[model samples]
Target: MPLHPFLSKTKLYKFLKTICKPFHVVFKYTEFVAFIDENRNKGKINDYYNKSTAYKNRFQLHDKLLEELKNKPIFYYEFGVAGGDMIKKWSLTNKVETSRFVGFDSFEGLPESWENKKEGHFDQKGNFPDINDSRVSFVKGWFQDSVYKALLDSEFNEQCVYHLDADLFSSTLFVLFQIFPKLKTNDILIFDEFSSRDHEFEAFEIFKKCTNNKWQFEFIGAVNNYRQVAFMLK
Candidate 1:
């Protein structure tokens, strides 16, 4: 039922928005849980889910990606490369010199507070990680930068593995919308903080709703209780 005309525009609703602000996160979380329940059963469910830490599950996903690609040259783009441990692992896992690995990070730290992590929580003093890989490079700036613009104008002729670890709803949504158009069949997409209901998970659900592109995916299984998950564009 629709709200009554008077209540619809009442200041009481505005007041409630201020007083009930904290529950907003809880509501978002609940919505995300429903999303997971709906989509988790799709495609394949690898046996490793919910049995290990997220870090280990992440490498497991990476190894699976390489195995599927047969270690071929590909494009790997990682958003939120704070200390770059995961990106570094990806570089070494695929030794193809022609494979390009690009990381996007402000390096200053988190642009905004996320849960218990305050702004600048992951501050690196603006230094890039020392990864000695010829095919690897860094885009040192916000996710919405020249690199994003370049991506908008670029083409991905080879297989692309996009790692969405931005850990913020705004950042994740920005990257998803930007790349949603360029995604090709069989391209891989990974989410490091996939279970963060108010962040990555919420963003993913919203992105699916807001886009008219009719993007379809192959669920490549989630690990660590859906904290780390992988999907394939279809």
Candidate 2:
């Protein structure tokens, strides 16, 4: 009879080796040490942020920005308004009486596959968060279709804060290029998935190289193992 895949001689031998005397002991100890080290690192990060002016969460960061821009006529743009949760929060927490909140999303998920995620991964089909605030509005289409048109109609000639959460290289790049000319020193830019090497990170690198713009890393927030980075145009 043909050998079963799971019970093949090589597999059995490896299994036996794993469970053997010193090897098993060593493996368990190594795993335990790794677990402890990971927890220690996470704890350090949390403790440091807890004691610093640097925000420990995205909401806190937004709150700080709102405070700083209070009573000013600021323009805030949020890309990838998934479920509209953050936008709604911004609308409610906003202290700037004349500020505008613009959110852009395809409402149909990603335009293309990113890494292991296939295209249409986050499609919401135009469903957005319900906000009664008149200052809040949305551009419901892909970045390429909606950004320029929205900008043309908007009364946003002043510096603005850009929250990029699209999580795709193409979408992020398109938006960055479209808005590059309007960005000025001291303007803030937030990258929701900045750690994703092939997506947001790559897009930002390309934008920096192409524009020769200088940016200062200002803050970082970590939650549930996901990280967000903020930068200031300089």
Candidate 3:
């Protein structure tokens, strides 16, 4: 998935805000916009603000969780890993080969109903780049309709960080139901688009019902104006 221009701008602005917050807010705002354009021109940014920020937050939480679960290994599984950017970065930076990074995507575009994804959503066509690392792999097809079949056809091990970023409500709901029974204590589930009013929120409500109030989630942080990531401890 190529980066959306609007999303990139938003991410650059956010990073700037965090670093420049304490030093004269009004002046910092002006500087932030200028820095964003400079960075854009230098081509130092990737297109996925939502996923990148979510990955960063998960790692932060993971560090805390790691201290709590010291002996246990770390692993991450994500639904809808567009362009495989987060997986690549985390694998390289963290250097955790034992901690598997699994990504699932249709590798095509969003389902027809997802056409209304307002804040820079699109149908990504074709497969992700060849990831040489054995720790990461991409599962192709819609998780909502094909989850069972996919699992039966393949395999996914236990994961510490489970990211749900699929744009469609039904697809996200399917993942919740499919993965719910497998969740264990201290497992973290991150919902990248939870701030969206429609699909993501609706899916969360359904997840609450399906979970029978057993699983509880809370917002960890906001990615930007268009997206926020939520964390569920299981």
Report the number of the highest-TM-score candidate. 1
Q: What is the lDDT of residue 186 in candidate 3?
A: 64
Better of 1 and 3 by TM-score: 1
Shift in Å, residue 217, candidate 2: 5.6
Q: Give candidate 2's TM-score.
A: 0.69
Off by over 4 Å in 3: 1-72, 113-124, 149-159
Arranged by lDDT, best first: 1, 2, 3
Model 3 C-alpha lDDT per residue in residues 1-234, reported as the tens digit of each score: 676687566688577668877665555445444433433322111232444344355444334434543444556777888777666655555455466777788877566456455532544666685678887777777776556665564334544777787867877888888877667766777666664445675687678876787865533333343254445464
**Model 3 weakest 10-residue run by lDDT:** 39-48
Question: Candidates 2 and 3: which is better by lDDT?
Answer: 2
Residues 46-84, candidate 1: write the lDDT tens digits.
543354464665666666666766478788888999999
lDDT of 2 by residue, 1-234 (tens): 665776664578577666686875666556544533444444212232243333236565556566666567778899999788777777677656788889999888887898788898888867876888888988888789889988878765656889998999899999999887677777878777765666786787789788765554444333323336556666
Clash tally for model 1: 0
What lDDT would candidate 1 get against the real structure? 0.81
Off by over 4 Å in 2: 1-56, 214-226
TM-score of each: 0.85, 0.69, 0.62
Question: What does the lDDT read for residue 174 in candidate 1?
Answer: 94
